[model samples]
Target: MSTSRHLSAHIDRPVREVYEYAADPLNTPKWAAGLAGSIEQVDGQWVADSPMGRITITFAERNQYGVLDHDVTLPSGETVHNPMRVLPDGDGAEIVFTVRQRAGMTDDDFARDADAVQADLHTLKQLLER
Candidate 1:
């Protein structure tokens, strides 16, 4: 099943700054609490380490907006899909985080994941505003 989490924040900075900050892999660890580090490749793929474990994110860019298609390998050896998008919203931007889990996961599991994504958005807002 597919589950999604969407969060919006208004930053005082221009859209370019916000979009650029979000696009840079090195800056991810600053705002995304779960992300410990990220390594980017010329092919637009990024390998990130988070608390849950490691994930490979493929990027597709269109102008200043982009989508991150993620495949996460959990400590339990289960792989999950967590695709996300960052789109320009007036002066700021909106972030949409989505996850598709295989069979056997409950709604509660998706809810927990959504909550974590929301928390990460809060952190992102804080970082950009500073």
Candidate 2:
């Protein structure tokens, strides 16, 4: 059974700025609370490490509209479907984070992972706005 979690946040910046900030690999560690380091490429892919574990993000697409498709791998050796997007909201941007977990994982597991992602996003917002 696949499970999913969604999170949204509003940032006081333009969509482009938000997208740029999110797309930058070196900046990930600053925004991602659990990320200790990251390896990025121009092709839009990165491998990030944290105390819990390491995750890889492959950017499938990115545009000015603030939309991105990527995959995330958890420490439990589970690969998750992550489709993160951003939208323009007045002078700011609205970010949406979605997680799709693999079968056989408990809801509690998904919730815990989702909470971590949410916390990371909140840090991301703070980093960009500051």
After superposition, the stretches of candidate 1 with alpha carbons farther than 4 Å from their true spots are: 35-45, 66-83, 99-102
lDDT score of residue 127 within candidate 1: 84
In terms of lDDT, which candidate is strongest?
2
lDDT of each residue in 1-130, candidate 1, tens digit only: 3444554555566666766777666777777765445555545556677776666654445354556545555657766666666666777666666654457768887677667667777887788788
In model 2, the number of clashes is 0
| TM-scores of all predicted structures | 0.69, 0.79
What C-alpha lDDT do the candidate models reach, one value each? 0.64, 0.74
Displacement of residue 23 (Cα, Å) in model 1 is 0.7
lDDT score at residue 61, model 2, on the 0-100 scale: 59
The CA lDDT at 119 in model 2 is: 89
